[model samples]
Target: MSSEETLKRLALETLEQDADRIVQLIRVQMDNLTMPQCPVYEEVLDTQMFGLSKEIHFAVRLGLIDREHGRSILADLEKQVSDVHEAYYEHREQLKKANK
Candidate 1:
């Protein structure tokens, strides 16, 4: 196979492997109790999340996959993270109200 094809295949495989882990990280962050309480924890979590995003961008730029396709996939993943965050906060608010 051509180099481009090989890269594309690799990109797909990497996405398959890392996508779940990325989402899990986001879920953990959303549900984290101590993240807001600790500046260091928040910073570390942010750094790791952003780092994963950057890695995906770099992979596309490096021709690991079609740039447009990779961007679409990343966009979907971002939306998922947003949804998770929204749900997490909503649940937290409900819990707080219940305790009142």
Candidate 2:
């Protein structure tokens, strides 16, 4: 493929790979996030995930990536974010009940 096509392909692949790593991070954090009342990890994860989604949007707008791939990246990250948020809440509730 031409240079432009090669760039686009590489960009899409990088996006998917990075997003997958972030999801894995979320899963690992969820597995051990039950430490003493600490919000740092959750806050950082949310911020990082949001920033990545925004980067995907900007990459598409700048013509670095195609719209379809951009949408897919955002959608995948959004779903993972939702799942992580739900798990965090459930764990928080469990902790509260335990403490009570």
- Pairs that collide, model 2: none
Off by over 4 Å in 1: 1-7, 35-42
What is the C-alpha lDDT profile of model 1 across 27-76, one tens digit per residue? 77767753444688567656755776777788877878667776776677
lDDT of 2 by residue, 14-64 (tens): 888878888887777678765423588768677777878887887788799
User: What's model 1's overall lDDT?
Assistant: 0.72
For candidate 1, the per-residue lDDT at 34 reads 38
- TM-score to true structure, per model: 0.66, 0.67
* Candidate 2 Cα misplacement greater than 4 A, ranges: 35-38, 84-100
Worst 10 residues of 2 by lDDT: 29-38
**CA RMSD of all predictions:** 3.1, 3.9
Clashes of 2: 0
